[model samples]
Target: MRTALRPHHLRWTGERDLAHAIYGTVVGTAAMATAGAHRTLGGTVATVLVTVAVYWVAERYADALAAAVRGPDRRARIGRALRQGWPTIEAACAPPVVLVAFVLVTGDLRAGVVVALAVSTVMLSALGHAAAKHAGATRLVAVGCATGSAVLGVVVILLKTFLH
Candidate 1:
């Protein structure tokens, strides 16, 4: 079981981080728009819940993926698998944390959520590339994902502006 959990653990961490970014952005935006400091507390709570949910979902996904990759001798390979996966996890998670912090501080929740989603998507793609030994692919994927996210953000903002 432990062995089966190793590979996907890092990916799960990344996903949880992504969720934190999203929750932080949403809560912060709500707080800022409503002129209520108490919204910060709510945002914090949302962030925690989102993070926890992300962790749980990511953990399950990672375990399943690891199990698929590891096969019968997965237990024996646990340490090696963890060692290999840790860096990818770290790489995937770091950007979202920084971006979330920036969004929260700047009170730009919408942009933050879009960026976070984009980053999360790119990171997932990078992880796939990591497994395949194609580092260059991650760069392209990130750019594409980020561009798409930005477009979505703009569209959302425009719609909100016009509709409201």
Candidate 2:
């Protein structure tokens, strides 16, 4: 299977969106934890998972709403919603899983959070690079795309820093 970081096919385009969601979740969750919210690692993981689930559900709901508005058939609209929103819902799982794994292994909650954030940023960077290469962009353009995507992660990090 192609991952966001090593994507090599058209079907892997969904990885790009996953990369963004993962990064956003990691950064946002980490920030909230550091703000004296997550007193325990388990609590942090649970909170993040809940947030991810909510996001996934929200995406599905929005898609269903759009499908209903665009078409008249109930079954067809439900199918359209599933097709349009499944990628994002699936991708959104990556971050919470990563966070949970780290939290479970590492005794230090802060360190676990940092590691999760790093992993998410790396995934985003890889997705950016793969997307550019898949588009047959020049080396400079590819590099730019990678850098730009990675920078978005940094923006999240900055938000964590200032907001926390």
Best-performing candidate as measured by TM-score: 2
- Tens-digit lDDT string for candidate 1 (1-84): 664456543533444343433333333222222322223434533553455445545654675567658657776565444333
- The residue-by-residue lDDT of candidate 2 on 74-129, one tens digit each, is 77887767655344444445555676687678666666666666665676676678
State the weakest 10-residue window (summed lDDT) of model 2. 1-10
lDDT of each: 0.44, 0.61
Q: Tell me the lDDT of candidate 2.
A: 0.61
What ranges in model 2 sit over 4 Å off? 1-11, 14-36, 72-74
lDDT of 2 at 9: 30
Error of 2 at 47 (Å): 2.0
What are the RMSDs of all candidates, in order?
A: 9.5, 4.3
Name the TM-score of candidate 1: 0.33
